[model samples]
Target: MKKLFTIFVAAAAISAAAHATTAFTDAKDAVDYRQSAFTMIRHNTGDIGEMLQGKVPFDAKRVQQRTDALAALAPLPWPAFSTPGTESGGGDAKPEIWADFKDFTAKADKFQLDAKALQTAAQSGDQAKIKAAFAAFRGNCKACHDKYKAD
Candidate 1:
């Protein structure tokens, strides 16, 4: 009976470990989640830029709405690459993400920082500050996409 109990415990432990390792079931799901998050970030940034540039009149309500959307997207839990049977599968993600993981993470971090700055500028309702922050935020996006997103 003790031996049987030990075997059951071992099985449970192994199962838990397997579940932990495969936090995402498939590569496509991972890619889709990432793309969705990026879309949110991009859309919000574009909206803010248009308002800042006077292409669209500043709408405080719309600015706050987009800012909240971006804040929600900022905390996405990106998966690690090459998980067993998983592959990036022609997504915009460049191979350098896995090849140079540290640099890739740095770029992502910079993007978040710039995004926060943009949000702050928007909140302040200062046109000049908004323009400057928008430029800074867009620059980070361009830098990262240039290196880490496939054309």
Candidate 2:
């Protein structure tokens, strides 16, 4: 019975995610969703960065929370970028992204991988591991932005 209940919950969650992925009816809607996701990502990233840099004292639980958020949010924006007409939605994204989508996706895949790595490091509660993983994860942003994002 518990197994059946767990399966049912998983099914429901999948249904909800499907609904969300299809909720955007236009470029603007897609852009809005993606921007929202990025905002959350930035907030969590900022907190983690601050803690790591000694601007804020390290809080293990908070670091884990932020890393977990980063891992979950990292994958949310890519699909929206692929949404039809998102190019015209007038965000910071540059045309180079669409021109070389393959490259952009590769960078995005790296970003997600780094986010997961940071999450794992945070989970292990090792400050040294977190610092190294965070550096790699944060570097992914600048590399992508230098080519794909507008000033």
Best by lDDT: 2
**lDDT for every model?**
0.73, 0.92
Candidate 2 residue 137 C-alpha distance from true site, Å: 0.2
Cα RMSD for candidates in order: 6.8, 5.9
The candidate maximizing TM-score is 2
Q: Candidate 2: misplaced stretches above 4 Å? A: 1-24
Residue lDDT tens for model 2, 19-83: 77662657887888888998999999999999989999999999999999999999999988888
Alpha-carbon shift of residue 74 in model 2 (angstroms): 0.7
Clashing pairs in 1: none
